[model samples]
Target: MLLRAALAALRRVEPVIVLEQLGSTFFDTALQMVVRDRCANATDPGRSREDSQQKAMTDFFMTYNLILRLTPILPSLLLARLSDRGWRRAPVVSSLCGYLLSRLGLLLVVVFSLPLQLMLGAAALFGLSGGYSAFWSGVMTLVALRSSAGDRAKAMMRVELLYGLAGLVGSLVSGHLFQLYTASLGHGTILLIVGTLLNLLCLILAIVLLQVKHVSSEEPEEKSLLPPTSSNATAVEASVSTNLVNIVLLFVAAFLYDFAVGGAIGMLGPFTLKAPLSWSPTQVGYGNAAGCMIFLTSYIGVILFRRCISDEAMILIGMLSFASGIYLMAFATTTYIFYIARILNLFALIPLPTIRSLLSQQVQPSSCGTALTLLQLTLKFAGLAYIPAFTKLYQNTLDWFPGFIFLLSSIFTVLGMIPISILGWRSAGGKCHVRTQGGKQPRCHLEEVPAGTSQTGTET
Candidate 1:
């Protein structure tokens, strides 16, 4: 029974998470080396090696960020719209193709010592296929379509848990993989090959095993996940106006929170390689592994706290935890202190997924693809702005203080808490439960309910 249950769960869950983790682990591990190689190759013969290398790295990153952000916006939007209109597998399969090609591009870069600028072309291809925006939106739609509102938070958390666990394993192994074949196949070719294979597997899985069903937003009364509640049923209903307001607020919060987190992740590798902590590749991999640990710990946190606290409260706590940890990271000059800061960020990933689950509850199932894709758009657009800004900031302060970038990240995280706080306060004050149901504005329920949990009591 346990084996069957596990198999059933795997069949229901999306495999994109594992594939993405494998590719990301390989890409991030190779990115720094690629930049360094490009810089070395570009330096004028007998020139100031340090200055030339630094400039090359900076230029490469700035250009990479710009292309990555700009190229995908339109394609991802188009792909997402088509998915919403019934072409569900297009985005998933196409994005996997992009990942495979991109990894292959990286492999060629390491194998033939191709120009670093070639990756920009690969990035363009990735964007053309819709990249992560379309892929994630599609995956989120799959998750939402498979579960009801009350179970969505759990479902999303489970996906995140799998994603993080895969990331942890990938990160832990990536350094060894890179090192093992560096002498035989150049620096990062082996890792890139592995990533490409992983992407291919995902593409195959999507083509063969994955099946997307269009679940109805309005379930039958007899089959409702929430049991009928005569007295408190109306309390959970929200007016359309109120729902609109809350959703807008949630998106704004998501934008701010992601800006901080994404900016930090984008710049951390180069920053660590320079100045106070000149970490080796192994150390870099370990640092990334530690970051992946956040997912596992955050998953555990959700399980432990969801029963006791509201999702809104959990999001608030997540934002604060990230802010504190990132703030401390700005002062971390040693390896030990850096790891300590990572430990402090155990709950950093909770807010985004929780916010997404909350947003899923506000929309009908048919709109999940559109809604989540728009959310992904907001985040990717935010990344477009933040990555360039953070890279520039890190470059300017590299000599005087490279850690300044982290300080700015910490500030944005603090700002992200505002909307969450407002929502939490409103919920605490008993103004959140009176919601809309079946075209009727019902009376507000006074009972405290978590953001995604049904106020009317759930099925056993």
Candidate 2:
């Protein structure tokens, strides 16, 4: 009975997911405060110029991004490989430890007013702990293991919804929390402390309350060393290779889409903190909360449209929504216009989850961790390229047109949509068909519909 109870308790990792995201989001807002404060302090003494602060913040972010991207590649890859080898919780626990330390480091910074560059060390520590790449890759593997392929889409969407909801709650209260002790000696210290506590709690929960064992699928029968062995084995190898190629395509799509979104949002806070739409901290929190709400709206979109449309179509619609909204944001002169543009992004959250689901379906269970980690690696590398370019572009155009960064983001988003469009065209026109069965002689046929039958008569 005790064993059964333990197993049952271990099955519930959702709470851990929720708390982790909540803590991360809360710290995210606090880090924004840190950036603003540190930038003002780093410039000339008693200088509070917006341009100086902006430049300081940009420089800090660029450095932080570099550290985050460069440090995680090897650790995340190693941790993911370990996870696939049955140490399923290794990456998750290590990554949570990273979060704990990073948050704690930030909290200390807030309490002591340390140098802004210290956060770079913190970021490096976090990356060494496998950071977001390993953590999310582990989480995806867990989700995939627990779900059937047919239901994996909904399962992944459920996690994204939870993540968004936690972020929404965190963002809604973060700004207020940041102000609560500002008049006291602590200033934003209380908020960071709370975030640290939350991180510690999540790390504890992850260590004690979660249990997972990843058992890899049996290896294929050993083939002869010589080339061109059995025809059947050759066909199997070719099929596996093709599936991998398709998954790589999915990752590329995700990389481009994430680049567009990340670049736009990275500059958004600094942009809003400046003239024209000079937003207060509360407004910034609300703006972030609005972005979180996109996940909820996209979840609803998945529910309503997924039944009638394919995942690719849903992704296409989401890409278009982001492209349109971001393009309009280039002309958003007022906060109201900005909010309107955000509203137009209701479908913006669909593409990543849908693309992830599609990718998850293409690979075997054993490769889930590696596949997801590589996908994240792609995103990180994209960030490495896009963050500096976008920051420089925004800074250079700060006087005449800061919104040009959003325009560039919209263009990348459009570029992302093209791959999905090609995928959809291929899928719908019966050019690409993946066999669902196993074994070397798996049955295959051209996916088609009879001339006299309805569109859905034989194919989705």
Candidate 3:
């Protein structure tokens, strides 16, 4: 019941969250166009009034963009704490309330002044939507860890499938809406209406989730099957020498990988729109939808191969696939080639959840949230450091030396594959003993079951 309610609420709010994100992307594009027009006409002899208005709008959008980046980090920190405290449901409720109130406030502000409304509304939507990504990522990670090994891959696949479907539908619809109402209704106004409706639906879902009952700990059969070390005493010490080594290696690898990939993606859409391969907004949206489709299909394949192959092998395959995709993208000469490269790139990402799941199994459950959060923080920090530099390089050099920036990005991705290769080699050589399933005792190596032993199946 609790799960049903929670899912219902998620479904309700998800569309609004998606719409807001789409709107933010659209606003960024629109703001860029306005800025360009303003700069072009700044020298006009009789356009002083228009110049002033354009400058004001440009400043507003720039400020809004800055807030969009910063505001999400604060809420993410709060959500991290809530996750650590096991207040997952409470955070969901809070997010819903916050989104609704922000929307209502924006609506009133817009009523008083259209300009202020656009600025504030864009900022609020961006922050709310951006924060939702991390919030949902954390929630899904927890869910994956809590589930049985048999169900873990399937659950992750399901989440990916839903995310893809949302992206596909949302992007296509938003694009059509914008094209249809470009003259009649501003894109911002239409986005606001869509967002409001989605938030209301999400609120209803959140209310429903409050009534679902969690399983009782006192149930005799359940108690017998539960893992040992559920108490605070079992919290893994962060200072333990071996644990510290593993953690450091994991963190470094995550940082490098995310830094490269994040920087590349940060510039991807913008570069596509303004470069040798200038793609229209609809084309970009379609590309994104295609990537999601590829990701969803590859995710299913990952689940299917989970039992047939070792985790190390899977990771290696994913990395290789990713590296190949990056190289292909670096040399893409046409839209079709770009689409193919993106599909391959999506396939390469299939191992992310699997890798995270592996990391979770290495640590005690009590510290799972902290471990995951640390990894997330490291990746985000790396991305922040690298994105601007890469974006500048891509923007300045993409036209004259097409593919140069992409080539550099591809090199970074290849470098990231090194640590994963090392880890995979170590794992396949039987050195790492991280159990992929929940259990009372930490095993030193993979289990050796009788050839004929029957394995129990759990629901996905």
Choose the strongest candidate by TM-score. Answer: 1
Model 3: per-residue Cα lDDT over 275-379, one tens digit each = 446666467657666755755776776777667765545656766666677677777777888887877776566556655655554555545555565566566
Q: What TM-score would you give candidate 3 relative to the actual structure?
A: 0.70
lDDT of 2 by residue, 138-220 (tens): 88788767765545667777888888899899899888887877554476688788888888988888888786634332322
Q: Which of candidates 1 and 2 reaches a greater TM-score?
A: 1
Candidate 1 wrongly placed segments (more than 4 Å) = 1-10, 40-55, 182-184, 213-238, 429-453, 456-460
lDDT score, candidate 3: 0.53
Please list the C-alpha lDDT of all candidates, in the order they appear. Answer: 0.77, 0.78, 0.53
Q: Estimate the overall C-alpha local distance difference test score of candidate 2.
A: 0.78
Rank ordering of all candidates by TM-score, starting from the highest = 1, 2, 3
In model 2, residue pairs whose N, Cα or C atoms come closer than 3 Å (at least 3 residues apart or on different chains), thus clashing, are none
List, residue by residue over 9-50, the lDDT tens digit for candidate 1. Answer: 555545667877777887778877667656765574543565
